[model samples]
Target: MAYTGEVEVGGPPDVHELTDLIITKAAVGPMDNNAYVLRCRATDEQLLIDAAAEPHTLLEVIGADGIGAVVTTHRHRDHWQALAEVVAATGARTYAGRLDAPALPVPTDVPVDDGDTISFGRIRLTARHLVGHTPGSIVLVYDDPHGHPHVFTGDCLFPGGVGNTHDDPAAFTSLLTGVTAKLFDVLPDESWVYPGHGRDTTLGDERPHLAEWRERGW
Candidate 1:
């Protein structure tokens, strides 16, 4: 991949520390949406998470050398507008949630729903069905070859916020209760959270904010 700007910026978290798990954030599109690249250094395997915008920027970071697959978080344009462009670049297959199939550009080769795992070399990513922002929204969890477990949350949950509400009030409520009961209830407090935008955070930092989020009816 070729990037016009530095792939690593801000230097808040040492890139070397995350060497085993190569994660690069690219600001794609005019909305400045983030498209992430997750690579297993041990195997040089890569997965592009959320091909929403900025195909060139994302490609630059992942490079043209190695890309195993591309995973979409939801159906929103900010989450998948550049998917077709990405697939064309690396010949990588994409995985989308079943409910998001209708919004995908090419539905023929896409994988639907959850409980499916995409593995590259020694890295295995388990897809969890996390519906909130969309009925098909999912969270990808994996244990890097180096032994740290990380979760790619998409837009489901953010550092100081949650995904926006859906049209139906009942659906929004379900999204909240479902995730809080299923995902957040079981994951470790220290688990790392990589949202679709902004900075990375730990579950510990977000736990307290859940109450306020729920109170605000988000």
Candidate 2:
């Protein structure tokens, strides 16, 4: 079947192929958190984004090839519930946004800042820091040489609007500003957005609603 980017907990993952990379997205945990397994086609080196839950399931998806690194998108418990177990099992190094690194259950091997690169095999993802969802929430961007760019947005950008800010105007403003400048303004509308939970969306699909999102203040 074609990749639809829609997954359910306990269901099969949706897989997409790129020129040098293969992305496998799975939904795990009661919260329905999304975990992405990226494999480099040339070297087969694997990197996991968010070991959210169900270590056994994640490990199974990883297979015997093993993973080289795990990157937690933020400090949220739901996003890293299985971090310790997965890391312990695969002996994978951990990476997170510098500001949110101290709060994770596992030690962050690399505290990343904006513009830092996370690499596995021949592929690299650029980290873009977007504040307000958390002090250091980040989205990973893979500028595919063969196709449109793909981004892994961790609890920051979703299908309808930005992440929840609990009604705090300042926080909402900060998130919206960062998302607009760093994401919408920079990336092309064809860029694919892989969010932390639920289904995926593209920049083109959400761009027109920026004003509405700002006015609604969510």
Query: In every candidate, how many clashes are there?
Result: 6, 0
Candidate 1 whole-model C-alpha lDDT, 0 to 1: 0.72
TM-score of every model?
Answer: 0.85, 0.99
Clashing pairs in 1: 1-59, 1-60, 1-63, 1-64, 2-60, 98-113
Among residues 3 or more apart in sequence or in different chains, the pairs in candidate 2 whose N, CA or C atoms overlap within 3 Å are none
TM-score, predicted candidate 2 vs. hidden true structure:
0.99
Can you write out model 1's per-residue Cα lDDT over 20-47, one digit (the tens) per residue?
6667666565665667777777888888
| Per-residue lDDT of model 2, residues 18-81, tens digit only | 8899999999978999999999999999999999999999999999999999999999999999
Q: What local lDDT does model 2 show for residue 166?
A: 82
Query: Alpha carbon lDDT of residue 44, candidate 1?
Result: 80
- Span of ten consecutive residues with least summed lDDT in model 1: 5-14
Task: Give me the overall lDDT of model 2.
Answer: 0.96
